[model samples]
Target: MSKKTVFKTASLTFLLTLIFSGIAFGQNWQTDFQKSLQTAKAEDKPIILVFSGSDWCAPCMKLENEIWSSDEFKNYSAGHFVLYKADFPRKKKNQPDTEQVKANKELAEKYNQKGFFPLVVVLDENGKVLGETGYKKLSPDEYIKHLETFVN
Candidate 1:
């Protein structure tokens, strides 16, 4: 192949890879609460319900980028809690399957998701309300502290 041809091919491959990887990574964000509860029961962990606007809300984006997506937060979160995310975007845009969107809507109703962005609800394996909080800005250390209170 010519040098220009090789460059174009490599660029296209990289872009496709990125698109697919983003889809996979983003899919992990929406999980069933019942399944999360099952996992929490098996693991003896609490459930951390993250209510977010993955596409548009400012603080929701910030908490993900600044805290939840960080190594520090993920590392701590991985073992302590069965994490579930309920997304109520200004527009339903997560491209979730119909069942998932329906379930999430139920969870949103049960959780009383009042059109707010970045609502955090912590629950036990039995769905007992441990507590609730909202995050506008939190550093990794700050987030860990807040999470620790609920989990421990």
Candidate 2:
């Protein structure tokens, strides 16, 4: 590659990492408890809610980078479970709207306020709690194995 091209590539890589480093830290998990139940009922699949520290937490960002961004994760999550995000950020200036915030609070309360960053919950079609867990240092292969249960 040419010198200019190399520099540009490096710059782009840095920018990408920096951008993700911020918006990708504590993931603002979407909380659609009703929707999760609806989707689960429709598709006959479970629901997995991923709550993260999307802007300030290292492990949460690492999980997003090393695991969820992959084609493996995307492909696995597709056509299987209903995925919900319920995020709490230490620094998220341009956050979601009021309704979303209220819903997140409700879901957090529903989960008994064990609501910590990086909380992962699984629920049945009827919105019954199946499982809840915190962060784990899962390699891609290990992550794939973990995701298997959520898939049909």
For this target, which candidate reaches the highest lDDT against the unseen true structure? 1
Candidate 1: tens digits of C-alpha lDDT, residues 17-118: 997665434323437777888888888988888878888888888888898787666666765667888776656556577787798789878885475668
TM-score of each: 0.75, 0.71
Give the Cα RMSD of candidate 1.
6.7
- Over all chains combined, what TM-score does candidate 2 have? 0.71
Q: Which stretches of candidate 2 lie over 4 Å from their true place?
A: 1-31, 147-152
Candidate 1 wrong stretches, greater than 4 Å? 1-30, 90-93
lDDT of 2 by residue, 8-97 (tens): 999999999987654444322336678678878988877877777788878778878887775556555655567787766665694667
Clashing pairs in 1: none
Model 1, 57: alpha-carbon shift in Å? 0.9
